[model samples]
Target: MGRIIAVANQKGGVGKTTTAINLSACLAEKKKKVLTIDIDPQGNTTSGLGVDKNMVENTVYELFLEECALKDCIQPSVMENLEIIPSNINLSGAEIELISMENKEYLLKNNLDAIKNDYDFIIIDCPPSLNLLTVNAMVASDTVLVPIQCEYYALEGLSQLMHTIDLIKERLNPKLEIEGVVFTMYDARTNLSSQVVENVKENLNKKIYKTIIPRNVRLAEAPSYGMPVNMYDSRSAGAEAYRFLAEEVIEREDEDAWL
Candidate 1:
């Protein structure tokens, strides 16, 4: 079965979508069959991977509502070996609609189970909130990869997210584990960035990836161009960092398989 990972952070503007997009692309670059799912209503990951979210006939919303099959929603991205299940504004009301549905939390999990063996990795770009959609993603995923911005309030609300994860693990998905945390927007010149990293290392008990994504102009500009940083600027620092992160992720997966 494919390893399903949800790239999530309740805090917005912390490079959550960026990590999801770039990491998926990098994994595909390594020749891994990747399915990147944009569960975020904003659909940034959809567009970031060069899919026109507004143009897609079938999206994650339709899949969630059972309007379409999971395979129907899966669309090929511009990048080879990377496919996407796009999302749009239609998903914004999913939380409300799902509230009345039976076994709503397992809806995504059940759907994904049928197609899990087709890909090597399935990366979910969750909405930047601990809403019903996020819960669904958590219930569906094997692990959660959190992106923490190297800013002053880096640790704020982190405990709440951890608590939410714990609750989900206890009540819904016993297999759910934190993939690890990756630090983003690190500035080499700033003492604050270093301090923030140190602070998280001291306070957070979860695994932290050694790859720290730098605040690169290319990384910020890639979304506008509808391409991942690796494709937008392969030589850039952001691309290099994400590529390294992908390597680490694959290494960890290998270690897990060995055990």
Candidate 2:
């Protein structure tokens, strides 16, 4: 079965969605079957993969909150090895609606179970808040990947996020683990970026990824064209960073395989 991971950060504009999109693309580039679920109401991951919002008949919101089948929402992406379950603005109401349902926390997990064997990985792109949606993602995930930006005060809200993860670990998903911490939007020219990286290296858990995503304009512009950085500009630094991250992930999985 595929391992489910949630790429999440409560802080906004931390390159969470960007990481999710490009990471999925890079993983697929490695010949790994990947399924990305966009649970954010903003649907940036949907558009980032060139999925038209209007054409989406079913979404992760429907699969979780409405008991829709996973197959109903899953759609092929432009990449041969990649697929996506897109979300729309209508997903915003799902959080509130899900609250009143029974076994609400398990909805996402249950939904993913059916499609788990279809891919090597299921990546859930979480919303930029610690709301019911985030809780759902946490409960559903086997591991969590957090993307922290390189900037002053970038650690703000991190305590809250960690506390929530701890709580979830204790009360909900004991099997859930942090996949890694990834540094995004790193500016090599700035001393602060270097400081932030140093702090993260010293303070964070040992699994922090080695690939630091640079503040590349091409990374920012790719989404506007509804494409992943790999497909948009494979030669760009941002794309290469994600590809390197994917290689690391592949190596880690290979190690796990030997175990």
Clashes per model (N, Cα, C within 3 A): 0, 0
**Model 2, span 1-259: residue lDDT tens:** 7888899999999999999999999999999999999989999999999899767888887787665777888888878899999999989998778767898888888777777888898899999999888888899898889999999877788878888998999999998887888899999999999999898777765477878999999999999998899999999999999999888777765544211
Q: Residue-wise lDDT of candidate 1 within 1-259, one digit each (tens)?
A: 6999999899999999999999999999999999999999999999999999999999999998999998899999979999999999999998888788899999899999999999999999999899989999999999999999999999999999999999999999999999999999999999999999999999998888889999999999999999999999999999999999999888875644211
Alpha-carbon TM-score of each model against the true structure: 0.97, 0.95
The prediction achieving the highest TM-score against the true structure is 1
Model 2 TM-score is 0.95
List the pairs of residues colliding in candidate 1: none
Flag regions of model 1 displaced more than 4 Å. Answer: 254-259
Worst 10 residues of 2 by lDDT: 250-259
The C-alpha local distance difference test score for the whole of candidate 2 amounts to 0.88
Q: Scored by CA lDDT, what does every candidate get? A: 0.94, 0.88
